[model samples]
Target: MFKIGYRTVKTAVGAAAALFLAQALDLQFYSSAGILVILCVQNTKRKSLKVSLHRLGACLLSIVFSFVVFETIGYHALAIGLLILLFIPTAVMLRMEEGIVTSSVIVMHIYSLKTVTWPIVWNEVCILIIGIGIALLVNLYMPSVERELKRYQQLVEEYFKLLLHEMAVYLRSRESDWDGKEMIEAHELLHQAKALAFQKLENQFTREDDYYYRYFTMRIRQFEILERVMPLVASLSWTYEQSEMVAKFIESVGAAVRPESTGLISLQYLHELREQFRVMPLPTTREEFETRAMLLQLLSEMEQYLIIKSEFKGKHTYIQSV
Candidate 1:
């Protein structure tokens, strides 16, 4: 299968548009406008705009250096080299290194003309404007990633459900043969989801606080808690009565995992479970004591997980259960 990406399409169209417009306007070194378009088009709008500004600034600076150095040192090959030697450090110091390559083209155009005239300067300016302007226009058509973000959200929730349900199963039977591959899957899923969420954030101009990004951050925190809980669950050599109780609670929590879940109900249930454990009979043997102690720690970790989700709900008040 073969496919063309959105950025590729934008670059091709933008470059063609710049070249046609520059030729129509009769600008010298008109092809340079197309090169600028190719260089300016970026993955994100913010990045494209940033790079455009850098290129524009660097080109203007190069024109100034070329006028001064070429006029003073004579319009020769060595003058061009000398201009670059000075321009590189100044561009780096101004944080416009991204524009260095694009600006070099402008320098070459001035060198070919072998003169520092107002018309030549204006010609290069028009070229920069046409190329960078077309790029900015093309970049403004960023496709929405809301659907993809939602898909990742559903995937992360599914992974959480599977992990929690399996942990419950382990606590109940203690004799099952279950490989913990879902843990690794869930970790990787969260990593990818977070990256996508951040990309979504970058795509926006005014919305500084992206909901999905924060959502993934909360999930990552809960996943960390799960990582800690996994060892405790696996270390249970013998299941006690307390283990069954915790298993049932985990099942309930897993059942409630969703985007709209506040985890308030589950948090209240956990509080009651802790109280119930406090009134239970003391462990009869050393092994029972250790197992019961691990169960208590597991309960604490689950509480942290639910608490994280509840905190997320506080920030997003529209998330309500049906």
Candidate 2:
């Protein structure tokens, strides 16, 4: 249970590599390169690259600031304090706030030397390059999260199937005692699936969109519609012939829930179902009218759900076979 994560291993190896390279090159304060590696490594490629850029920029800025401020005022404790006071605001203004802590280390190294010289400056530059470079190098090999993403996708589909089946059961028999736990479980599963999908999106460098992320987004939208349909189904005390038809349709939709389903066939069937409902005799009793109206609303929500799936599949045709 105390196993190390991939990112943790990356950080450990990167830090050690930075220290080793800096020591081999005889850079001053070689341990600082290890610290830089620790600070730069991140869980995602995009995040790690972004942080490395920010730290690189901030460290360079700190060196320039130190060169100017130390030469002008004198390298004293007060000068170091002044340097940070000026450096922090500049980093924030430039949107490099992530590098503030790492850059501070560079500022101290320059301050400890008590003078600004090209040799000292070159030494700090080497340390910066070695540290950040090693971090970036190690982070280049991000283990594929596709397997985990697929696992979440399977879980979400199963929950959707179960939830739809339960809804159909309730609609068909208004007297059943279903506890409605699947709705909550589906909601939580979609939430986690979306988060994982987004992580997968962030892991890729060139991909602007992820199939799993969009898939989860579409499911979340449909889940919201399902939540609306549930109360309407539960409120029906008297089941009519229309309710039975809708229940069967819901069962079919449940059966269709899978990655390969485009929902186009379901959408066509739903349109036919709507046409059939149009020719049915108008409700006579006040209760019958309300129940029929609610059934109509439920059918409308179901149509929206199918449309969402159809549109999603249309945009990403590759998922049809996946």
Model 2: worst 10 consecutive residues (lDDT sum): 313-322
For all predictions, the C-alpha RMSD in Å is 2.7, 2.2
Q: Per-residue lDDT for 1-322 in model 1, tens only? A: 8999999999999999999999999988899999999999998888899999999999999999999999999888899889999999999999999999988988888888889899999999999999999999999998888899889999999999988898999999986576888888888889998998887777778554578988999999999999999888988999788989999999999999998889999999999999999999998999999998999899889999999999884335633421
**Weakest lDDT window of 10 consecutive positions for candidate 1:** 313-322
- Give candidate 1 regions above 4 Å deviation: 313-322
Per-candidate TM vs. native?
Answer: 0.92, 0.95
Q: Largest TM-score belongs to which candidate?
A: 2
lDDT of 2 at 137: 95
| Candidate closest to the true structure, highest lDDT | 1
Q: Write the per-residue lDDT of candidate 2 for residues 1-322, one digit (tens) a residue.
A: 7899888999999999899989999889999999999999998888999999999999999999999899999989888889988999999999999989988888888888888889998998899899999999999988887898789888888988887888888888886676888788889889998988887888888564478888899999999998998888889888889989989999999999999798989988889998998998889999989988998899889999999998885335754555
